[model samples]
Target: MTSNTAMIPSFTPSMNPSTKGTDHGVEDGVTGEKLLFFNYHEYSVKNYRLIGENTEDFHEQALIITHFPNFHVPRDSNTFEGTRIVRISRYFKGVGVFVPQFSPYLPGTEPAAIFGDDDTNAKFIVQGEYMGQFFGTSSYSPLSEYLTEKEFREIVEEINVQLRDAYNSWSLINLLLFVLDLLSFWIMSDLIHSLSKRKLDALFNFIDTRNKSLEKRGIKIISPRDSGFLSVCIVSTVKT
Candidate 1:
C-alpha cells in the first residue's frame, strides 16, 4: 500500500477568535469544520491506512483500516455519504473510520478548488494516523523540535530503506511501468514549473508598467521620501 506520514499535534491556526472564521467553508449545501486533535485525547488513532479505487471521485466505496489505542470497537462500521464506506481491519483492532464532511468555501474572490476546504483538517488527522510510515515507531515523537539534525537524517534513512525494499520487490514488468510513471511525474512537474514562471513574469511586468505610467504622470514611484518632498514643495509654493 502506498503510504506516507506527518508530524502530529501539528501546527494549527491560532486559536484567536478572529482567525476562527478562516477555518470553515460552505459550498454545495454542505458545511466543513476544522477538526484538530489534541495529544491528550482519551483515545487517539495510531495507524490509518486508506484503500480506495483509482477513481476520479473519492466519494466512491473505500476501506479505512486503523489502530486506536485503549479503545475497542467492532470490525465493521456503517457506510457514509450513501456510497463511501469504511470497515476496521481484523489485523488492526480499532474503531471504524468516520469520514469527515467537507465542502469548498468561496471567499467572494477565487472559488475554492474541489476538496480544498477540508485539506487542513485532513492533514491534521492524517498526520496523527501515519506517523509510523515515515518515522520509526520508537523514534517518532510529537516534539520534533527536540530532535537534532542527525536524528532527523536517521529517520529519513529508515523511511528510504522501506521504500527501496518495496521498489526492489517489483517484477521486471512492474519496474518498467514504474519508470513510465516517474517520467510522467517529471513531465508534469516541469509543465507546472514553466507555467508558474510565466505567471510570475507577467505579474512583475504588469507592476513595472504601472510604475512607469505613474512616473509619466509626475508621480514619483520609488521611495516615499521623494513623494513627500514633492508634496512639501507644492504646499510651500501654495503658501507663498
Candidate 2:
C-alpha cells in the first residue's frame, strides 16, 4: 500500500518556495513487489535560486535505505509532486522473493534523468505526486569539506557509469550530469550528516535530562514530499 509518512511540514514563505512545472506529465506506475521490512524515512525539498540571471527552480533529493544498497526494492512507491520517481537496482529480486529490509529518504533536487545502469535485476514503477515548489526558496549550508579529492573523483566516476548507459542523450549532456551530481553530493553529504548529528544530539540531551542511560534510540526527521528529490527507500540484507 502507498503511504504518506510526512505530516505537512510548514512551507516557509520567507524562503519563497516555487514549483517547476513537470516537463513531463504525471504517471502512476504500479504492479510490482514491495519489501518494507526496515522502517525507512525520506524527505524531498525544493530550492530556488534568486540571484541567478533569472530566478529558477533548483531541486535536490536525498535517501537512506536500510540494511544495504544492494537489496532490491520493487517499484511500488508513488511520486508526490515535483519529485521524479527513480529507482536503482544492481541486484534484481523478484516478487515471491523474501527479504527483510527498509530504506529512508533524504531531501534533494531531481534531475531530468539518472545514470543508473547498475540499477537492474528488479523492476519498479514511479508515479508523480506533487508538482509545485518542494521547499523553502531560501536556505542552505555551504558545501562541507568531506572526502579528499581522490575519494571525490572515485564517486564521480562511479556515478557517471550509470548515467552514460541510461540516458542515450549525448556526451555533453552526460558530462553536465556528472558535474551536477558532484556538486550536489558535496552539498548533500553535509545536509544529511547535519540532520543526523542533530538527531543524535537531541536524543543524548533527552537522556541526560532524564538521568536514564540509553539502551537504544532511533529517530530521524525525514520529509516525504516535494518532487525535486526522490525519497524511495529499500531495505535488505545485502551489501553493495
Candidate 3:
C-alpha cells in the first residue's frame, strides 16, 4: 500500500518575470522615483471612524501585494510577513462580480505590449515616470523569509495563473460589450437625432418662460435670495 503522506519540496525557482538584458526582473526604463501601486486585502476591521476620529489601527492584519512597480519590490511596506493566504478568495469574489470589465482598453490582439511579460500579478496603470530623486528604495525584498525560494516561486506561479485567467476572460467580455455598444449606437442614431431637435426647442421655450417669471418677480437670477423665490415661481408656473 502507498503512503498517504506527501513529501515537502526543498527548493523552488524565482517567479519574477525576465526583462531584456537585465536579471533585475523589472521592465526597462523604470526609474526609482516612480509611484508604486499595491493591492491590500484586509481580513478583519473595527468600526468606521468619521473625520477627526482616533482610528489608526482599524485592521488587525492585511495581505498586501505589489502591483504598479511590477516585478520590483517597493521600499515602503515591503514586508508581507504574518499575513494569511487570502488572494485566492479575493480572486474568486472578483470573478463572480465580472471584474474583467475593468481591463485596460486597447486596440488589437496584442495585450502583452501593455501588460508586459507577467500580466497576472502586476497589472496596473503606469502613472507617468519619476523625474526627481527616488522616494522609495529600489532593492528587492522577499515576500517571506521563512519560505524557501522554490516554495515562494510556486505560490507566485499559482497567483499569476489565476490572475491571467481572470484578466483574459474580462478582456473577452469587454470586447463583446464594445461590439454591442457600437451596434446599439448605430441602430439608435437616427431615432435619437430626431427626438433631440424637439427636446432642444422645448428646452429653449422653458428657459425663456423661466427668465420672464424671474424678471416679473424682480429677482436677479444670480442672487442668493433668488433661490427661494425661484422655487415659488416654478410652482406657480406648474399650477398655471
Every candidate's CA RMSD: 27.0, 22.9, 24.7
Highest TM-score: give the candidate number.
3
**What is the TM-score of each predicted model, taking all chains together?**
0.16, 0.17, 0.19
Tell me the tens digit of each residue's lDDT in model 3 across 1-240.
011111111111112122112121222133322121111211112223322434433432211121122111234532212111211112221233332111111110111111222334232222111221011111111222223345434433433343344345346654565466588976644444423234334433544554565445322112111232111111111000
Judge candidate 3 against the unseen true structure and give its global Cα lDDT, from 0 to 1: 0.25
lDDT scores for all predictions?
Answer: 0.24, 0.25, 0.25
Counted clashes in each candidate structure: 0, 41, 2
lDDT of 1 at 3: 11
Q: What is the lDDT of residue 106 in candidate 3?
A: 13
Q: State how far residue 229 of model 1 sits from its true place (Å).
A: 27
lDDT: worst 10-residue window of model 2 = 137-146
Off by over 4 Å in 2: 1-17, 24-26, 30-108, 111-141, 144-240
RMSD after Cα superposition, model 3 = 24.7
Off by over 4 Å in 1: 1-182, 185-193, 220-240
lDDT of 1 by residue, 10-61 (tens): 1232211112223222221222233322111112223343323222322221
Clashing pairs in 3: 12-150, 100-170
Query: How well does candidate 3 score on lDDT at residue 21?
Result: 25
